[model samples]
Structure formats: structure tokens, C-alpha cells
Target: MSDLAITLLAGGVGGAKAAEGLAASVYADSTHIIGNIADDDEFHGLWVSPDIDTLIYSLGDQIDRQQGWGRKNESHQVLNELEKLGQETWMTLGDLDLATHIFRTELRKQGVRPSHIVHRLAKRHGITMPILLPTDDVIQTRVKTNLGALSFQEYFVRERCQPTVNAVEYEGASIAKATSESLSQIEKSDVILLAPSNPIVSIGAILAVPGIKDAIEKSNAYVIAVSPLIGGKTIKGPADKMLTSMGKTNDSKGVYECYAGLLNGFVIDDQDSMDATWLETQGVDVLVTPTLMSSTAEKAQLLSKVIEFALAHRNVRAA
Candidate 1:
């Protein structure tokens, strides 16, 4: 098998799960990620990057598995006190996790670009995989729903995804440019994996960055994606609803259509076998297997399969 230089596009939860599996199955030095920044926000005057923090904590084996985000064994004393003082405490900032926010915010205030700050944060957590944002510029995703265009956190977390999303737009994508690191990673990648992240919130936001889509389309790498939806439902989050609400197909097929010319291969669950076969005729190579990540062993198994698929398909070496 040819050694691979892999680039992952991801957000939190499902992305983290697939990341964990991939981390276990590959040389850490060979994998890099373009992390999702859609859910970033400020709380208590500090910057909180929820998805990036989730990646850091998970890679460091310190994630609260039950909650799926935040540090393991988190202390909420600070949040409790804030609530007692009648502060807006919709977002909980844990004691140890607070340190990250404080450090990142301070760095930002000191003119540290977000990309540099992210690298520093990842290093502090001993994360081996090189991860960067699509850009250092602020590009918040805004969900336009019945409630109007709200920041991603406001739409998803604050409203609990209760409102109907009529459209979603990246607030600053019109002039957003991909960082040199992101462009370089795409150029050198042998295999690019889009993890099973929320399509609308995570993947969509990444693609919204102006030149990144064109880069992926023109890259020499075999770009493959694991569908976030399985069995006509999202494994988590609002991808299914968002797809249907937009008058688009809401299954793995919908995901294939979303990627269009960029994806050379699509990995769907065995349950979506029919969709996989149909997508094959559309010219996307299909890999079907169990995509669930209930435990470390199961995750490893799926990762092993994905790696094998990437390698075998690498024979074609996408142009």
C-alpha cells in the first residue's frame, strides 16, 4: 500500500468519532484536518471554539463521551456562579476548558491570527495531527430560518434546532479566502476524507470558503466522503432536515449530490446499499459498510475499512 497523506474536513461529534478511528488507523504525522469553526462564539468575554475544542479534547482522550462535547470530568462552578449572578449562561464553560477560551481570546486580542492560535492550542493538548481552519478570517455560518438569520450557535444550540431552516448561508464567504496551509494540504493530499459531520453546518460552511471548492475539484487527490446521513436520517444533528427543507434529497444520495464533481468516492452505510449502487452509476465510486462508531473497537474497524478503501482506490489516483 502507498503511504498516504490524508486531509480530513470535520466538525464536532461524528467528525471527532471518525477522526478518532482514523487517528488510530494511520500515522498521526500523515493526517491533517481543516476543522469547522461554525459554532465558535464568545461567552463571558472569551472566545469559545466548540468544534475545535471537541477535536482537541477527543484527540487527547479527555472528551466527555456522554455529553459528546466539552472536557471529561468538567467542573461547572464558574457557570453556576454566573447563573446565580443572572448572567446570560446559555453556554456552559468548564473550569479547565475555560483556560483554553481565556488563552485563545487573549491571543486574539494580542493580534494572534486564528490559524496560529489553533495550532498553539492543538500543540498544548499534544494533538499530533496538523489541523488548521480554512482561513484566519471570521466566516460565521448563519442559518436563515423562520427566526431570521442567526449565528450557528444561536440557531442550533440556543433554539435547540426548533425553528424551520429555510436557508443557510456563510456570513462572510463572499470575500473569504482559503489559508495557504489549507490550499497546500489539498495540493499535497493523496486521499482527502470528509468525515461524517453535519453536512449543512460543518461541510457546507467549509465549502462556502470561496476558492476551497475549486481547489478540491482540481486536486490530484482521491476525494472520498463518509455520508453523515444513514437510513434516511442523520446519525446526529440537522443534516437530514436541512437537506429536505431546502428541497434537496436528504439521504446519502443527497450528500453525493451536494459534493457533485468534487467527490470521486462516497462511503455510505450498508443500510444505504441501494443508494450506493445508484451513486455508482452517477460516476462516484461507492464503498458500503457499517458506519456506526459506538465504541473504540467498532470505530477502529470502520477506520480500517475506510483506509483499505482509500488505498485500493488510490490506484486510480484522482486527477
Candidate 2:
């Protein structure tokens, strides 16, 4: 189990939580995370990568557990000052959190690859696990709403996801080149797990990158996704709503449809067992378990089951 090289495709709070579980598991040292980059945006002239930072903070045990993001015991003096200067402050940037953005922005301007910058940041924070970015090239999530198209930050933070989403698009994805490091991780991994993240904006954004989906399709590793929706509703975020708006059922079935051909198996809560037969008919194995991870214990419990499932499949594949 310690020798197993597991790569996770993840984003958002749920993704961070899953990463934390795996990081604390016995396979922690061999685990790698490929986080979404499309949620990135410029804030007050500094590059702010919310999803990536969340992963880092969660892994480092520096995350504000209550809010599930930003630094714990953080002060928002920077945002308060910006607000006083008549700058929009919808996106809260704490003083400590500002340091990360400043450092990342500086390195990015110095022409460092985003993946390299992430490695440096992780190292500085004492995080030993590999954090891979799907692409260094700029790819932003755009939400098309009845009012107008808005950047992911605007739709998620400024507008508070209140606007009716007509559609979603990954700007620059077609032209964006997938990071070699991430592609190699996928190819070399023993197992690939899709974190219980927003299927549309988080995991979907990573897949939208040109070579990423192809790499996953080509990988010999078994791919499994834990459903973010439990009982057709998201514990946090707009995943359920987005899936519904996108003409998909807001349940485990919708999640399976989103991942479709890429998944070898799907993990769903016992409550969503109604979709198990349908999914199995589509040639995807179903694992029914308690998917909620509100506590660290629960997280480890779920991850242990996932690891066991992966190991069983790997042995069969090897045979």
C-alpha cells in the first residue's frame, strides 16, 4: 500500500478535504494532487489562486477549518484598506493570505511556471506531498448567466452564485497546454481518484484542459470518482444546482454522466443507491458507502475504503 502511487484530480473545499484524508492515510507519502487552475483570477493586481491555495492550506493544516478556506486566525486588514481605497472587496483577502498572492504574483511575473511556483510554496510551508497543477497556461472558468457572462470569482464570490447559470465555459482551455508534470503523474500512478469536487467548475475545468482528459483516458490506472452530491444535494457550493441547470440529473447518476467513460468505478453514499443498477449497466462499478466527511475520522474512514477498493481492482488488473 505504501508503494502505491495515487494521483488525485481535485478542486474546492471538498477536494481539499479529500486530499487531507489521503495525506493522513498510510499512502500519504506516495500521494500526488493535481488541482484545478481555472478558478484563478487577478485580485488587486495580485494573482489569486483560490482552489490551489485551499489545497495547500488544507494539507499544511493552516486552513481556517470553520470556513474551509484561508488562513486560520487571519486578519483582513489588506482587504479593509483596499475597500477604503474604493476597490471592490467582494473577494476577501486576509493579511496573511495576501502574502501568498504577493509571492505567487511575483514569481509568476518572473516567468516561473505555475507548477514550479506551487512546488516552491508547498516546500516553504513544509508540505512534502506533490501538488501538481493541470496546466500552467491561463484557463479561467466563465459562467454564462441570464444577466451576462462573469468570471468564476465574480459568479461565485461577488454575485454569491445567485445568478441563474445558463451555461459554463472554460476560457482558453482549448489553447492551454496541460502541464507535463501532471500528465506524467497520471501515466505513472497506480490509481487515480477524482475528489468529491464540483463536477462542473472544479473537476470539469481540469478535464477541459487540452491533454488532461486524453492523458486520463490513456492511463492504465483505475479511475474512481467519489460523488459530491449526496441525496441529490451538495453539502456546500452550487454543484447540484449547476448540474441541474446543465440539463443533468442532480444525483449520483449525473456525477457518473459527467465523468462518463473516464471512470472505472463510482463511489456514492448509501442514500443514492437507487442509481447503482443504472450505473452498473453503463459498465461502471459502484461502491456504496458513507460519503460524507465532516470530521477527520470520517474522512480517513472513507479513504480507507477507497484505498481497499483500489487495491482489490489493481490486483485483478495485474492478474
Candidate 3:
């Protein structure tokens, strides 16, 4: 067991970006992505897995770069038609993207779980990497906000994330069990990554699933998390606002505290490099590097820093 090699926990955009970095760093087949399923919802009788779809589209080169979601150059014919039919058009599903929902809904109707549906979809897109859903169960993230305790999509899409979130909860997580196959991958990984995804919603939702975090705690692999916030703001999404609403500052310290006990190491952006010494005082190893990845080269370099940082930590701890 030369440290069995790679497992990454991720959500959508931010997570997918960092995962792309890791994917390029290793043999794609060696990577396992344990993605967040809390954002899954049934739209117009079709099962839509937002996080899972983002990972696929990102890797498959179909992502809408400017929007940071949906397919690039996507058309909204299906959505427009649905609107004409008096359907709620709050959530936008593009024409090219509809093919995904159509395929997934059919499989799910035929009794396929989301995890398996995702695997089939990824393979169809020629992706060699393995992706594991944290659970095959219906564990969704619900935002306990001023508006209401709404499902992630309702709070995020239908209401446009305007609600003031008081807390985030994982619905159906208490009974949710981690899949054995996914657990085995965790057992085999050399390093377990906590992607720079929204910590409370994405990674938190996955950890809330019974048995998952316990396995990570018991595993021998190095657990690394990249901070999503840099200089009190997020690259994309309302993570900063979410943190503030939750009473955590929009800073690396808050993000660090979110995973303090679980993580063996953490990555902070170069802009927050000054915080490294302060973080080290808290007993968590810190790696300051350019966490932003606007291109393939930058992504690989960021991942390289992660690998380098982990190996260095191993050597120090072993000594």
C-alpha cells in the first residue's frame, strides 16, 4: 500500500475546478470523486443531479464557462417551451442539457440509483475517472432560512439565493449510509481531498451522512482541504454570504475552523499567504499557493502544490 493514491470530495464549480487540477496530476483512472448529492432535485418529473452534471460537463468540455454552469453555447428551447406550457421556469435547463436529464430520468425510473446513473453518464462522455456519490440515498441539503426550510434548489434557484440562511441541514442524512464500494475507495486512497467547494453545504452535507466522516477519521490517508474563500470573498457563489449568515467570518480562519479537527493539511491562496503562520499556530499544517485556476496550467500547478505539500507533511510527521 504505497499510500493507495487519490479520493476527492467535491460539489459543483469550485470543486470541479480543483478536481480537474487533481485529475491532471495523476492517472485519471486512479482518481475517485465523492461528489455532493444534496443539490439533486426533481424538475418537471425529471431527476436532475446538479453537482454530478457539473463534474461531467466540466470534464467533458461542455460547460458554460462564462456562466460557470450548464452547457457552453446552450440554447433554452426546452425551458422556453416548458414556460409556454405554464411550467415554473425558475430553474433554467438548456436544450443540450435536457439530454442529460432525459437520460438520467429514464434510468432512475428503471430503478437506477443516482450513483449508478452518474457512472453511466460519465462513461458515455468518455471520462475514465471514477466518481462516487457520497450516498445512493436521498440526502439533500436544506437551507434553514428566513424564507423557510427549503431544499437547496428552492433556496438557491427558485428564490435566487436571496433568503437569509440561518443554518444548513442535510435532509435524510441521519438514515443515509455510505456505499461499500465508495468506502473501499476511501480505504484505498493515498490522499483524501476536500475540494474548495462551499464547506457548509457541499462537504458538510457529505460528512453529515452517517459513517462517511467516521471512515475518513479512521483512514490513514492525508486529508487535505483547499479553502474556497480568499480575502473574505468567494470566487463564485454565495459562500461568503453563507459563512457570514452562519456567524463565521468570510476568511480563511473561519474556513479552517470549519475543518480544523478533520484535516491534516490545508491550502490557502497566495493572497492569504500571510495567514499561514497564524494557521500553523492552531496546529494545522498550511500550504500557501495560488489556489485560483483559470486555466489548465494554473490548475495543474495548484494540484502539484497539493501533492508537494502532502508529501512534505508525510516526511515531517514520519520523522
For model 3, how does the per-residue alpha-carbon lDDT over 141-225 read when each residue is reduced to its tens digit?
Answer: 8899997799998988888779999988888999988888778888777688899999999888888888889889888788889
Structure candidate 1, residue pairs in collision: none
- Poorly placed runs, candidate 3 (over 4 Å): 1-4
lDDT of 1 by residue, 36-142 (tens): 88678888899899889898899889999988888988899998999999998777789999999999999999998899998888888888788789987778888
TM-score of 2: 0.97
TM-score of the candidate numbered 3?
0.96
| Lowest lDDT 10-residue stretch of candidate 3 | 22-31
Error of 3 at 48 (Å): 0.6
Q: Rank the candidates by lDDT, best first.
A: 2, 3, 1
lDDT of residue 135 for candidate 3: 88
Q: For candidate 2, lDDT tens digit of each residue in 193-235?
A: 9999999999999999998899888988889999998899988
lDDT of each: 0.84, 0.91, 0.85
**Model 2 lDDT, full chain set:** 0.91
Using lDDT as the measure, which candidate wins? 2
Off by over 4 Å in 2: none
Model 1 lDDT, full chain set: 0.84
TM-score of each candidate? 0.95, 0.97, 0.96
